[model samples]
Target: MGDDAPAALVEIVRRWADDPSLLVQRAAVAAICEPRLLKAEGAAAVAVDLCGRCTLHLVGLPLAERAGSDARTLRQALGYAWSVAVAADPGPGLGAFRDLDTSDPDVGWIVKENLRKKRLARLL
Candidate 1:
């Protein structure tokens, strides 16, 4: 997967981000959240995009649908993943994070969790 073209890789990640399975979505976030991967040219933007898609997937699910262990796994992965992407590309990354509608409890929790990260605190 890492050897694929950047555009193709991003597309694949997008699909994973959109997948119904929370474990698959967690994999997508974990795949791109690596600091080394984010250092590659244009990788940060791709990470931010994919992360945003994953967040949307979470936010769109009904509250009842998010009660499973799979959802918790995805939420846990996202809790710290935003910091990596934001540190990699503050402009687009922060923009994407800030663009989320935090009124939704899940989105609010994700945003608050990212804000608590020291990495993001230092960036801010």
Candidate 2:
């Protein structure tokens, strides 16, 4: 089981994409792991400081706190973390959507849950 944070992060990022706050932006950047994506410093620059903490939460800190035992779970967490950053990019499905500021409250937590499922698939 992936627990709740992955879905929570997805929902939180979905909100951020429409609004693009420094906190959300930074969290996305921290989750991002792709070298090519990270190379585009302009995108991640908004949250340099937050990235460090976010990285820990996604990869290490959270696991230590909960005594996370499953490698698959950790890997899935990594995948979701990267997804949050990737979704923030101005491309694909996310690019088509309005800015994070747009009120799509109807989007609901289901989308967040779906994202969690997709990330877990990567581990599978």
Could you estimate the TM-score for every candidate?
0.89, 0.24
lDDT of 2 by residue, 2-39 (tens): 13344444445445433323344443443443334444
Model 2 clashing-pair count: 6
Candidate 2 stretches with Cα past 4 Å from truth are 1-31, 55-64, 70-124
Q: Model 1, 14-123: lDDT tens per residue?
A: 78888889899999998888887777788888788878888888877888889888888898888889889999999878878888888988778888999999888987
Flag clash pairs in model 2: 17-100, 18-99, 18-100, 18-101, 19-100, 19-101
- Ten-residue stretch with the least lDDT total in model 1: 1-10
Q: How does model 1 score by TM-score?
A: 0.89
* Whole-model alpha-carbon lDDT for candidate 2: 0.36
The weakest ten consecutive residues by lDDT in model 2 span 101-110
Q: What lDDT score belongs to each candidate, Candidate 1 first? A: 0.84, 0.36
